[model samples]
Target: MNSMKALSVIFIFFLSLVTFSSGDLIEDVCGTSSDFKVCIDALRADPKRCSTDKKGLVRILLQQCSTKANSIYNEVASLLEQAKEHVLIQCLQICKENYDNAIDDATSAIKYFDANDFLAARTSTVAIASAPDTCEETFNEPPVRISPIKSKDDDFMNFIGLTMRDLIEDVCRTSSDFKVCIDALRADPKSSSADKKGLVHILLQQCLAKAKSIYNEIVSLLEQAKEHVLIQCLQVCKENYDSSIDDAETAIKDFDANDFPGAMSAVSDVVSAPDTCEETFNESVKISPIKSKDDDFMNFINLTASLINQFGN
Candidate 1:
């Protein structure tokens, strides 16, 4: 035990020597001092000194500086673990300074990106606002000294957009005419439709799409933060849904008040029309039993007989 204790002391001494000699690798890139207040302030004041391209340079600095900063932090932490009372305080101070400096570098990158409003240009306008904190919460780790917000935003939006497109196609397999009519009015960037009847069906489908959008946003928020945010978001969606249903009811009421027969005639036509289901199921054995010509003829005669019997009664 005594020999082991002596060996541990020698090892720590050697480690301290190494840490002290590795004076300032991070400082060389950032500056001569551990305090980055002056360095960060100067960069903001006249950012050209940092690099030629303001946005690109800020990103690069954050990326490169983070690795060096982490090394410094680890060294300081290790030194603190083996320090005497006198050196422990100094080590703690240095650790705090380095950590803050790294965070500031990250903050600078975020500010530069925000100033350019890059999020709007890309599809990540929403994710950029929420991801930094969300990523930290999910990892149960402190926010990284460097965050690739722009890159992450791009990946997230691309994946969601593709998924939404696939969902839309799978759910709505109407005729080309119907699809065209709905696409024309759906504010979708794809195709257009000319059939009036198809537009109504498409509108209802769009309501579902809107509900899904809000649900996704709520889920993403809940994943990142408290359940309260998700609940509030859902409440907003419910209110919006109610308002839309009320508007639709009012529109229908007005139409009926002005022309009840006209409204009924349109509804009757839709009821009698050969629906998409009939077109798609035409050859299936299940439907042929009812739609065959022999069955139709028998049904016609039976209907006439029933009418004659009714008059006699």
Candidate 2:
């Protein structure tokens, strides 16, 4: 976790929705933000911030907002499935419904923003921004239960207050599974201005995020395992995930240093981490406790490798 966080520190600073003059778009837009330094860092990392116009940047923001809402929706649903308490379940249910609306509103905002309908996009943004409040307030009601998804809620709102990668078309055309390629890019705003090398960079980030998420979950699951088969599967999974994290970070560094083939080779090793993990559970005849996480990571790593395969073709 520390290594992942340390590696991500270089990329974490990004901007949200705002327009500004030509002299310093990142500076001007980020300056308007409530969190100045954080905003500055985000836009600073974007090599295209100065060249990309205001409209393009805002479109990126809206698309990212939509992407994040979908993630939050899925996360809430997962939490809802595990909640045993009546009040907690009820709160999650409310959050689930609200996030569903947020997903639509943020998606709608993208279309409206794209169509030059600023008024409507603003309207949608208003609806998008309300979701966190509604969800957070639901947990604050009498017999209050802490929202299991508070971090997600806060991040969602903060997005409304930071934001997409332009995806699918060209970069995905050569992907083995085109749809999976698109899905892998859903949460990446830098993709809007990224090229082939850049897309690999984004896909590697996606793969790493999924890998890290599943690895953390495995750490927790290991603390509770009683079945021998499950423990054995999880132990193997931990080993796979551990190596995957190292490979992904190495790939990212290679990409940054212009060693494209080296990056590809590293990520090729990465693609097997989830596959091996899943096969362990399958061979042992045990349903993987982290099935969704495994599948999600698999999807990301596959796309990362597939796109890298197409780079020289």
Candidate 2 lDDT for residue 86: 86
lDDT of 1 by residue, 197-275 (tens): 3333344333334334433543454356445533444344334434433433433343335443343333322222123
Top model number, lDDT: 2
* After superposition, candidate 2 runs with Cα above 4 Å error: 1-168
Please report the TM-score between candidate 1 and the true structure: 0.18
Whole-model lDDT per candidate: 0.34, 0.68
Best by TM-score: 2
Please write out the lDDT profile of model 2 over residues 1-313, one tens digit for every residue: 1111111111112223443576776565545444566555555554666677655544544455566678778989999888898889888898889889988887887787777776566557656656787888889889888778787666554444332122234577777677878765655544433445766788788777777888898989998999889999999999999999999999889878877788889988886788899899999999988888778777667767777766545
Clashing pairs in 1: 180-192, 180-193, 181-193
Model 2 TM-score (2 dp): 0.46
